[model samples]
Target chain A: MYRYDEFDERFVRERVAQFRDQVNRRLSGALTEEEFRPLRLQNGLYLQLHAYMLRIAIPYGVLSSQQLCQLAVIADKYDRGYGHFTTRTNLQFNWPKLKDAPDILDLLADVQMHCIQTSGNDIRNVTADQFAGVAGDEIEDPRPVAELIRQWSSLHPEFSFLPRKFKIAVIASQADRAVMKSHDVGIRIVRNKAGESGYEIFAGGGLGRTPMVGKRVREFLPKGQLLAYLEALLRVYNLEGRRDNKFKARIKILVHEIGIDAFRDRVEAEFARADAFSDDENAELARISAQFEVRNYEKLSARSETFEAARKSDPAFAEWVAHSLFAHKVDGYAAVTISLKPVGGVPGDMTSDQMRFFADLTDRFSLGELRVTHAQNLVLPNVKQDDLHALWRELGKAGLATPNVGLVTDIISCPGLDYCALATARSIPIAQAISNRFADKARQDEIGPLQIKISGCINACGHHHVGHIGILGLEKRGQESYQITLGGDPTENMAIGELLGPGLAAGDVPAAIERIVGVYLDKRADGETFIETVKRLGVSEFKAAFLAGAQNEAA
Target chain B: MKLLDRNGFRTDDFSRAGADGAARLDAVIVPFADLPSTAARAGKRLGVDIPNTVTVEQLAPHFEKLALIGIAFPASTDGRGFSLGRRLRRAGFKGLLRASGPLIPDQFPYALACGFDEIELPDASAARQPESQWLQALGAITLPYQRGYARPSSIFEQRRQARKEAAHG
Candidate 1:
């Protein structure tokens, strides 16, 4: 959790006042809708179908218990008593009034949070591995660098109005939990052969209408040159990125058209011109890193007698063992994932009361440290093994202790037609239906690790493109249909899912998913996971099972 | 229509001296259609010969030639022209900048920060309302290529080094 310095605090305060004036002008009819639209968007306010939506940045998905509590207060005070965590690792208030937005921003500023650059054609909220600090395989924690980038890109003068939105992701681990390869700019912290820590930079990766895996632009950029390298990259894109058509404006398209070699040449040339690193920037990053230091853990025995006894007696704790836990870097501690996807509940959503409870739990069991994973679930990174049972009991009451952290029913979904104006069909209902279909805990456990991602539209907010079984909601004529894709994964071995034959109507989508999962169950070898089955069987088999009925109807 | 220069003076300052102690000069008030070409031709014909200027309904088209431009803020908080002034400076057009027509002293610092060299207050009463009150307030004055310009030792690099030192120390 990086604390705000004097400069950071002042910047956010001034930005809030600036937006407050803009809102006042718009409300007074001094600014037209066309004129005020971009201004409002730059401040993270959107005019959705029903009400104004405010997307708040949770920098690199890190949050203190106090910050989470503040967010809960914002939801209760201004929104519909709950907030939706996004795939980008930020949160959105689905229902905010246009007038109260400034007040909400003011409140956010008080807690060192803002909606700045959360949307619009500017550098967006930087995302990174949620378990950056505590992950056992990490080279270093990447949040300090992420915080530096956050500060540098905030309301940047030249890059504020880019051809399209830019997204950057950082990963400090070899496991690639942050999905760094699927971002506009992906940075991985690595140690060179000489044992000096540096950054391995990737460019031109994105997911949207056109999906691409980023190419390596720099093999090993020195740690101090991160800002200079970024400046060169953005400068080239800002000047040369296509603004003629909205669809063809992303850096990925530019990279594809020019070829990665030529793009690399140009970026390197630009980097050479601006090769200097300033002392001020280094000093600032140093200050930021100091704020992110992990709390010292007490030396303890490797074995936990209490935890072993509880797990032996409790079946619920046993179930939690199979799904909800991950090995921590320290001995006798574990990272506990709090699943928001209770069967038949909305994905990535937490009620106000639940948020407050999470705040308290993080303080008590996790050393006031919490992380929002890219999967839209919360994590308690350093929970002692002895405290797991008590924490699980408290979480069970809040509907968060589902014991299905990475299991089949823990679906990733977006607020599709229910909240998004661009959505052609509803996504929440489909997610709910699928969750209900697999509501039985025994059935879910039997199915094993299956990621079912649903997106309301092609925007892939639900991360449908990276799900084991991806369901994309589309509208044909006046009816809703779901186009399914198979074999997408967002882990270290990332791959975009391939679409099956024809889409299924809304009524048939759930059954179609059941048929596909059933096909996996039948065809899988002994002790194989869903992804393994998909990898071995490929899409043709799933396609045959998914579209068999549609083919029959046509015949 | 009174055509004012960047220094709040009439165009007659270098041409015909003020008659009856009131500034008057030969100025062409062009319509929106003829503003650009006419301003260019006027700049060519005048060639710094006499104190001659052209005024138009909009300033965006003639930003390159006019040493001094006047923007009618129309009403209070009409910020389209404020953007115009900023763009002019960002585009590297450093000349006499004037903001007139319904503009007040409250927006003085913003106008100045946006590259307006001079501001034409409506009258003496508007000008007398404590210019210092708004003058001292700082405005965001950033270079056009601030993000693009990569100096060898930048703020981000400095911050990074500082962090390393603190961590190791």
Candidate 2:
């Protein structure tokens, strides 16, 4: 909801110009592909399997209707009339030409967006909880701090070439919707005994070839010193992180190699050495926080007559409300999650027309803003309860009203071997098969609150390491094989999933998942979710079911 | 090798110290490992060329005796030198700080903002990215977002001053 100031505008424009010049230099053979690769990657241009992909950052997952419309326009004009929203809450146009990337960046700059630091070994797009301001349990809005960080880290002189990519996530609520603990640096807003706001800082949490939850470094860092502390932490990691092996270069690996206490002591020493915090930083924080102030809300009754009538009249409407609606901090408002995962559809993919439709609905129903959730869905953070029925109706007309927010059908998947150059197997088709197997809405509801994440490779872009039912696709011999992991959690109690026995063949994946779900159904107690059932029944039973399924397919 | 400053191409006044260890009156640059032996032979304007891995604490005690500190980048992508430059300045190194390696024009602004006085590029890098590119890249963004550095005044302070003026006027 924050508008770009003159400085921000000029900064993006200059970046675009610089990238354009780089592109020209590449075209003229003044720079080799190896020389140009990192430059383009820092600007979020990737040479994918078939073509170039341009990923644009939706800073902190927040987007205005105007910006959404512009994205739709860019998709139609430059891409193949579609864009895929990533698990990082960014969007990828998979078919942009290298020549057209600068033009696309120019278009994004017009909408206060750019793809800077979206990829590369730099401090990347800072993420926060999608429901920051409107969440019922929020201590403070995390967006202001996220934005301040975005500004400070953008094209940072001392940190542009880190040994590995750095991700920072901020969360204000205890729910941990942003998966804060799995980031390189996680900041949780808290109040001390004196009721003054501060931060609980965690460092070195990530998911990839190696998965480790971040360790708490500072118990209570004053809010004013956020940037200073982050600078100190990054300076330590930048100079000291391993660089000999690319796979072992993440800050999490550094923290693991040398214990968290040593890492914290180094960071603290660096913090004491540098004069990072100053009056100018406080003023900057104030300037940023002023932009995130809550807008005027009308004092409407908490209970809406139209909403109640619609719920009574329509069973489908009630079902959607049950699954999609989230409680808002405000009495008369609610946050509405529009599922991007429809049955048998590719996860996180949206056509240009669907994007335009959502933009229009955003203007009409919610405030003029919506947010992209890390779960690969869109959220209207300020939908009025009075407008819920009408909103549901409009969403249904556009095929956006799928009541599967946390259901089995709401899968998070990556663009595997089909698009990504590094993937060994296809992830989208596998996600589709599983979603179709559980397409029955009643069955999905019966299963209840399952998170199925599928990643095609070990890079873990799809976050298979944290899913309740995690599926990692690997190439065994030549054919595609899928490995299942159970009971992984991404919440405040973050834990990596363990491998459930051996891998299964591609055809047996859906049936294996079915058997796993069947086992859960048989073993679950009253109102127990999939995760709880897995925890109760243990992985041995699910492993037996999966092995049986795999054997049956083999026979 | 080529020397570049904010105004573009510049002449290099410093020469590398020879193995003979003879006294020189003008500026002479010596490797950090050779500093102990070269200190006696060098003149008042002594320069120490350090590897990127060398920390500020290692260089602090010798700061008063040197006129320049050159941080070696090895490769353009190895950004440890940038952080090293900033750390040296933050630790109150008022002497000249030079980033030496094969870096690009795109990195010129970062080099300057991180408190480097000049960039010493290998001949190949200088040939690929000429002086004009470096000069243009220096002015790529006239302002920056950081504070408490030795660079130009931040946009944050500028915006605050503007707000204050508006309020008073």
Best by TM-score: 2
Relative to the unseen true structure, what is the C-alpha lDDT of residue A168 in candidate 1, on a scale of 0 to 100?
Answer: 95
lDDT of 2 at A544: 86
Model 1 ranges with Cα > 4 A deviation? A278-280, A552-555, B1-169
Residue-level lDDT of model 1, residues B1-169, one tens digit each, is 2323233334332221223432233432333344445544443311111111221224445556554445555543244455455544555555565566544332444455456665554554243333432342223222111232322333344445556788799
| lDDT of candidate 2 over B1-169, digit per residue (tens) | 9999998898988877783442454778888997866553333588999998998888898888888999999877888888888888888899899999988888888888889999998988788877777888777777777765567777665787887788799
Which residue pairs of candidate 2 clash?
Answer: none
RMSD of each: 7.4, 1.7
Residue ranges of candidate 2 with Cα displaced over 4 Å: A276-280, B19-25, B40-44, B163-169
Residue-level lDDT tens digits of model 1 in A379-412: 8988999999999899887767888888888899
**TM-scores for candidates 1 onward, in order:** 0.82, 0.97
Candidate 2 local lDDT, A347-410, one digit each (tens): 9999999999999988987778899999999999988899999899998898889999999999
Error of 1 at A522 (Å): 2.2
Worst 10 residues of 1 chain A by lDDT: A275-284
